[model samples]
Target: MSKLLKFSAETGEKFLTYSLVSVGLGTVIAQVAPHVWFLDNYAGLFQLYKKGFAVEVPSHFETMLSEISDDLAIPVKNPLTRLLTVIGFDTMHFGTTSTTSGCFIGIPVNFNYKSEKDIDKLSIQVGNKSVPWDSKDGIELANSLILSDAAKRFGIAYELSLVDTFKFYLHCFSGPVIVIICGGVNNYFCNIFGLPYRPFPVKGVFYGLLIAFGIGFYYLSKDLITTYYEMQALKNVSKVGEEYITGGLEFYDKLLARNKALRNLLPDGSSEFNTDGDSIYLFRKKHVPITVKKQLLEKELEKLNHSNII
Candidate 1:
């Protein structure tokens, strides 16, 4: 095999160079390709057109998206923001979009049910004990999962606002940016200290540290971008109207309650989620907590109420 192609401690520089390029290309493909190839081309594969849900849910979402499309400057009719009902996903949110066409949104199939009986099939079953939909807590849980029409539109609007900005492209490019910066730094230091010719142990430790640093940098950037853009989306959603402002408050409240219910119902609830219903993150959190989200909307409502009283 060629010297660069051979896998050995002697060819550390070649390995490092290949690793950096591989990671950079991998990140770009993972982030951008799914939207372009899968979502835009064959979104119908993931779309749920169940007997009862086919007409109502998608039609409502399309109408809601169109109503706010002008205000948000997102196109409604052409290159449509497609809708799909995802089974495993328990909430509604924005999915990835194609750079060439438009974006898509995912709604949890469970979110389509309005009453307790309607969602019984999806109830949590731990061993033999099933979470009943008729009990007082069960009724509350059911109610929490189903949002008012106004709250539903607000949720859709929030997801729409998320894609309305240039943040997705920025997020996609972050992976390559980190790869370039880390690779450049490593190469600079290697040249200064004489790298590939250095002892095996020294080179190993140096490469390992650089890899760790790159991973840490990736996660930190990901968290910061998520936090900032989510807050910005909420701010944009608040501009729609008074009903949507009220809807935002209700949406978060219902989300928190649903998580609280899940915590009580599921077998591993306590470990999986906190008291406030946010996931118990091992390292960094990727989204705003439900409690904090609700509080922000509540503050907006308070301001609206005070202004009206005057």
Candidate 2:
């Protein structure tokens, strides 16, 4: 029985060690070569290319890129920040350009949907929440969501600002950090209370409690970090110019409007989204509330207007 207890302790230690090592390796891969796992569809690496979704990069998008780069003094040039058009509802940036390998930003095809056929294509794509409407209504809905040039620029700048930060790297390390801290705490408790030599039931409960605590801590910490950086990015991008300031406000307003439309259109509208159009999460949220985003930008716009008058 003594020999079995010793073996059990050793086995548990080995398992923890292996888990930590694997997570550390995964963190490294995610930071350096994220494309290995993420955006496979965007890269067309697996399965047949999604039809009618992959469109050529728009000419004006290039102009927006150049303008934003010049205004923000960020190097999001070709090869460093590759842009791809894919079928989706949102325009988003992936990975970071800080790595030698570069990163990608995806422009959703739905943003440019104009025709009846385009609306049909959008209806079938995944992640779409809109209820089926007539072709005329669909075109109107799509057009309503279509952002103006200034709003689009602000959106792109916001995305660029996020990728250009250490948020991604911090996100990668968050898991490992939580593991190391939790592991240390676990060890400390086990040694202090003689947990290892305790009966199986006691050990099981103790370890289970630690695992639960670790998961909670990890999410709370990550969400707080995400919220902080998201706000910081908003503030940073708002400083670019007055148009960007107004543009940022318009961007959030339009998004909220879109969400409101979706909430009415989706089957589970009231349950899935709040009246304000933000998705209602079960536990916690990683992104700032759209209402809050609009409020911040509105304040900035008011300040700019007052200053102009002065």
**What is the C-alpha lDDT profile of model 2 across 1-310, one tens digit per residue?**
5898899887887887788678656756755454524644435432213554446777878788878888888897643776677544666776676775566667665545444455554445213554455544344455556676788788888888777788777777787888888779878977898767788899889878887887788788778888888898888888887999888887787777767766666667677779987878889887889899888888888887898899
Tens-digit per-residue lDDT, 248-297, candidate 1: 88887877787777787777889877988787888888888777777777
Candidate 2 local accuracy as lDDT? 0.72
Assess every candidate by TM-score. 0.85, 0.86
> Which regions of candidate 1 are displaced past 4 Å?
1-10, 40-46, 49-58, 92-98, 122-129, 134-137
> Global lDDT of each model?
0.72, 0.72
Model 1 per-residue lDDT at 98: 36
The segments of candidate 2 whose C-alpha lies over 4 angstroms from its true place after superposition are: 27-53, 113-140
Error at 171, model 2, angstroms? 0.7
Worst 10 residues of 1 by lDDT: 89-98
